[model samples]
Target: MDIYDEIEIEDFTFDPELKIFQHPCPCGDRFAITLDDLVDGEDIAVCPSCSLMVKVIFEPEDLEEFLED
Candidate 1:
């Protein structure tokens, strides 16, 4: 089973910096993301070339520090 299946996502967002490391889509596309527009179960990224959406799942603890700030 996917790790994302076990957690309850409170929010979702995209990291523009992370986009730099994203591999090109099979169609040779690239994309960027921001943190405010993320959804719980949807892809937070897009393919610059194909415009395909990508989904990212984060653990609850992963966002704890952000919530505290």
Candidate 2:
């Protein structure tokens, strides 16, 4: 299954400065993504540390909300 297909964006936050979404990987791994790297409506990300490509479904906004709490 495609990453976008599995992902359901309940919330999201756009960070222009960072150029990436601060969110968790759909695989349950925490990671970050840049706007240039992301294709809208899709759940794909390149791991910074491992450089392993990942499919993400969680919205960045959800991560922000979690952080605020």
Candidate number achieving the greatest lDDT relative to the actual structure:
2
lDDT of each: 0.42, 0.50
Per-model C-alpha RMSD: 7.6, 7.3
Each model's TM-score, in the order given?
Answer: 0.37, 0.36
- What lDDT does model 1 reach? 0.42
The per-candidate count of clashes, in order, stands at: 5, 5
Candidate 1: clashing pairs of residues:
12-38, 29-49, 30-48, 43-54, 43-55
Pairs that collide in candidate 2 are 12-61, 19-34, 19-35, 20-33, 20-34
- Tens digits of per-residue lDDT, candidate 1, 13-65, equal 32444422243345665443433333232435566666465554555455445
lDDT per residue as tens, model 2, 1-69: 223333333333456656566555456654555554444545665545544454656655545543443
